[model samples]
Target: MQPDLTVSRTYSGPICLQDPIDKELMTESSLFNPLTDIKVKVQSSFMVSLGVTERSEYHGKAHSGTFPHDSNRTFNPIHAKNKAAYLQNLSSLTKRSDMRTTGVFGHLGGRLGIPNTGVSLLIPHGAFSEEASWEIYLAINQSEPSLQLEGSEILLGPEVTCGPPEVTVSTPFALTIPHCAEVNPDHWTIHLKKKKEQGKWEEVMSVEEETTSCYCLLDPYACHILLDSFGTYALVGEPLSDCSVKELKVAVFGCMSCNSLDYSLRVYCVDNTPWAFQEVILDEKHQGGRLLEEPKLLHFKGSTFSLQISVLDIPPFLWRIKPFTACQEVPFSRVWRSNQQPLHCAFSLERYTPSTTQLSCKICVRQVKGHEQILHIQTSILENERDTITFFAHDDSHFPAQMGPQAFKIPYSIRQRICATFDTPSAKGKDWQMLAQKNSINRNLTYFATQRSPSAVILDLWEARHQHDGDLDSLACALEEIGRTQAHISALAETQTEESHFSYSRQNGL
Candidate 1:
């Protein structure tokens, strides 16, 4: 039988205990029951199904390239019968508080090169359950003492696993709002800080929510956080304050099927709040015309409700749906809006036929419309067994986004997931619309052409010819073509200018 593993919280080092009696109890069946003799086999089989071997060691061990069930040993009839039960137990184990993780924890090392409120990270939607409490531990070299002024303190254990070298002065900052927001900017000042090598945090200027210049807007209380080498950010505001007009918390998603018209919205309410919500559809292909729908007053007792909107009711081509909500309570009343922080889902619509091999999409989360922060990309692959639901997060600074004119970045470490079911799982069948939903909130990602930076990449024909000798002739020919193209552009410009002057004189009857 496999060793019955036990990890004691108090044990500082690896403790190898071989208690004969305990071992017998774990492996051998009780004398009172004869049919329960196969319990050990069932337990072992279940462990294999859950991929427990992959997470057996406190520090992740190198993968063996084969799972426990991948062995040549034949399974008994009883092991096969209890497989479903084993899978359920494995799922529970993953949710346990003490579950081990393989992620690297350390000081997020990097320097801030952009403006004070520049976005260094982006955490997209569908990353975690709406009810789950998530925390990301960051070890920076500096100390922003101002963060201690607002939210409650979180005490981290001195014993960090796979973290950076010890540093002086550690402060725990709260990511979520603790109480109602009765005050305005004073409620909680958002600080932009930089960590110096001498182990000190220097304060950067406060970001403007209304301006399109800021990087990202954070909802400190939200479960999502994107980390980078340069900095970490949290949303700090009273979103439901009396000074703000409440915006609806809604997620729009389209099913992946052969049908083009089917789509749905998941309306969210926190802890049974009474809400008045409305949706206004606008036609963009035709002259901007608003198609009004009756307002919905929902006393949401449940956490969420998935509502399907019929496509026949709205215009085709390009359309914008406006969703707004109002509530009477403390947390539900404060609805804040800024160019850097507008809550909406931007979906890229595509229709997939049955002949399509796979499903893929590029997902992002930005502060609002126009300002886009690329967060992640998802692509589905074919498999025999059903895909297990999973979530992944990382501090990838290379995520693709047009930060400024000519400034473009790409996804660093692309996170992957194989979900057993999507938000709209039934829409997975063929004949559905291929929609890539973008959940951008709390950051200005607007693109301005006039103030854009020059992204000119200089190329050297000599270096190209030397490095790629096989393409030397091709490189030489390309350079010649480029030189000729410049002359053609100059000639075209002169022709256009002469034609404009002649037309101007003719129109004025000069």
Candidate 2:
């Protein structure tokens, strides 16, 4: 005969276990003791009970209203509870508007992305059990409290969070993050760090090095990572050699000084980060200066070479440069450590006559043993009603914010055909596994197996791996090798041709 136990939250009475067969009642103290041999079965309408077998021994200190830890104590619920609380608090700090959420089903995985941030998460099919589902979220840390960087360490991308940290997934998911570093394996060291318990950040892995648990594939503008767990993740880069490079945005702003005949030009070189550029724009606005021309990207190397800024091709008969040196040289350390303030050189030029309304010259910015950029300056010296030099505001829409399926160079129709053709298991070895092998995504076969359509997941990885500069001909060739029909191969080629023509037409404004 089995014991009958009733548990109720509304009942404030003491917890008791009673056996109908033995007609004996046990108190909470003896019922929870390690030495107790009694097994009580709880029946409740409002709650489900987990059964514990008879002779089970409790090994650790008992706490009120909590389960006892096992002898080995591999996990502590208290610590887990604390960590959960900590994560929840941090999550609350992020505004609800900044977070993007999507429904992820166990049988069918989905993706979550934050627009304009170049951050996305791909949840594979069967990451959870058939009955499991979750509302996953993706957010970028763009609020007042920003991530802290150590000495000589730079943040290459936005700090992103993909969580409900307590939710567990059976397989690894792909996370794509944008980075600004000019990646060179020999010159730079990059680390992926995750926020751990008590607000401590721990290095998850090095981008150039492979780890057993995680894999990182670096692209020109982004990084695709395979991770089993989820939390806050960020990319940090440290320069390892003088050849290491960081991108900088160079812009020239000009305005007429207090004297109408005198013009001042301010050349600014700042980190390519969005915030840094925005700050420069805001300051330029206050100084009543207008953008002389569109900004250009400079690949500033970490070499010890100093940067020189000079103006050339100036008409000596029409204008004369001020009393400073014709070329200004900036120290390597001063430009390399520029973050809070942008490095700039100011040049004042006096016109021989107020009637000289046009000024044309070449501004040369160069670094020894590095790259050089020449900006062609052609603008009206005096403020004319028909001045061709118009102020142009910065436009960020030209840059891609979202990268996932859209990043694939292959046409959508062709990709669908490939997925359908290779997804099924074939005895002839013309299946998704073979496709994965060809694409170099076969290392984690077990991870792909859990996905509903392994072929699609593999294609997604391929898209992320080559998002910046993917070659479509390679994929078409691979399809042919997998026994795809000539018709299918021809369709890919035709699509590529049509797209190329369309791109050419758009560029030529036809």
- Give the whole-model CA lDDT for all candidates, comma-separated: 0.23, 0.62
Residue by residue across 1-510, what tens digits does model 2's lDDT show? 121223322222222333321121112112222222223222321011111222212232322211111243233222455666745755664554534443333334545665444567776544655554555666766554245678777777667787667778776678888776888888889999998857778888887664566768777767898877878898888898877997877888888889987888888887665545655666788888777767777888887798888988888889889867568999987777675566899999888888887888888888877888888888875545334443223232343232222333443333554565567664445568888877756455755676667787677677555544534534543543443332345567789999999999999999
Q: Which candidate number would show the highest TM-score if scored against the true structure?
A: 2
TM-score of the candidate numbered 1?
0.22
User: What is the TM-score (0 to 1) of candidate 2?
Assistant: 0.57
Query: Candidate 2 local accuracy as lDDT?
Result: 0.62
Best candidate, lDDT: 2
Q: Output the lDDT of residue 154, model 2.
A: 70
| Pairs in steric clash, model 2 | none
